[model samples]
Target: MLYYATTGALPIPSGKPQYQQPSYYTSGDSTYSVSPPEDLDASVSSASGVASYGNSYSVTTSYAGSSQGEYDSTGSASGVDLNEYMQERFAATFDPLPLDKCTAKQAQTSGHLNAKHRELLELQAKAQARLAKTRARFAQGLEDAREVRNDLEWTQKKVASLKAKASKKHSKEYTKARERYPSPDMY
Candidate 1:
């Protein structure tokens, strides 16, 4: 009699075989069936008796079909050869130059320095051009200021000469004007 602890029920005695034949195990989308050899029962019993005395036991299994089919089928489902595709991708991205670590580092550093040198040269040229342009503008401004100062000085001198002529009392033109329009106070 077999007792089920969880169900708390005892199975009734029946005249049937103790072991059932091997059956299929179903998983998602796949079914697997395993059949034991004719003498597996005897071998397992003997193996179990040996294992009871603290001995190691191992089991080996071999499939009938070629294992390569699994990999080939998976690759074909994606429309490409997996091995070839991986090789091509690896080759495309792999860098094969400068095998030595020190040489690779030196090459990378030199390349960076060369790029920086070119950028510095370009910046220096631009700065020099800007300095030249600013100097030219400054010189032109100074020249214009000098011209304006000279013109202002010339105008001041001309105004002073005209004032000197108009203020003179004994000039011939002034005496003639005085006589032609005799003063009314003198009468």
Candidate 2:
């Protein structure tokens, strides 16, 4: 009553500051501190031309048929044959070996011993098998590389689509999303 009479307000008790959970982001063994959405501004943005948190975030809507034409879909099983490109690129230095043929010349002479003929044929067969296996492995590596390239391309397209959707001008949701957010140029 006295405090209220003198200051025209009741006495207020001070309490300890409440503990807050720190916000951060993780990316492949790295961590970054994140500010509150309202506190975000020019500082949080990345200068490497890549989108970071804060100004980078906005209302992102899915656009239909976004994935279509992101990559070539020829409807054929063979799409963007990397092997053809590789052959053209490296054909000069790394030429494919000719298949080794097993002939009578490789076998024993003077009434051709049966054991020697069998041994010669077996060696030839083994050599051919090794060559075939190596070729198959090379083909598999090329396929794996192609898959990685496609996946990267798809991811990039998806990110780009999201950025475009978020930054689109004549949209109700975009305006609403920017209610408390800063200018789109910050993004």
**Tens digit of per-residue lDDT, candidate 1, span 1-187:** 0001121222322443233332554446676653322232323322123421112112222244634133332313234566678889998997767457778899999999999999999999999999999999999999999999999999989977874686494477756876898756679
**RMSD value for candidate 2:** 52.5
Query: By how many angstroms RMSD does model 1 differ from the true structure?
Result: 16.3
* Global CA lDDT computed for model 2: 0.51
TM-score of 2: 0.26
Query: What value of lDDT does candidate 1 attain over all alpha carbons?
Result: 0.54
Best by TM-score: 1
- Report the poorest 10 consecutive residues by lDDT, candidate 2: 1-10
Scored by lDDT, the top model is: 1
Tens-place lDDT per residue, model 2, 1-187, is: 0000011222222353222333554546777553333423534433233454433322122334653223222221234444466668897776455322234445434336777778899999999999999999999999999999999999989988986877775477777766767666787
How high is the CA lDDT of each candidate model? 0.54, 0.51
Worst lDDT run of 10 residues, candidate 1, spans 1-10
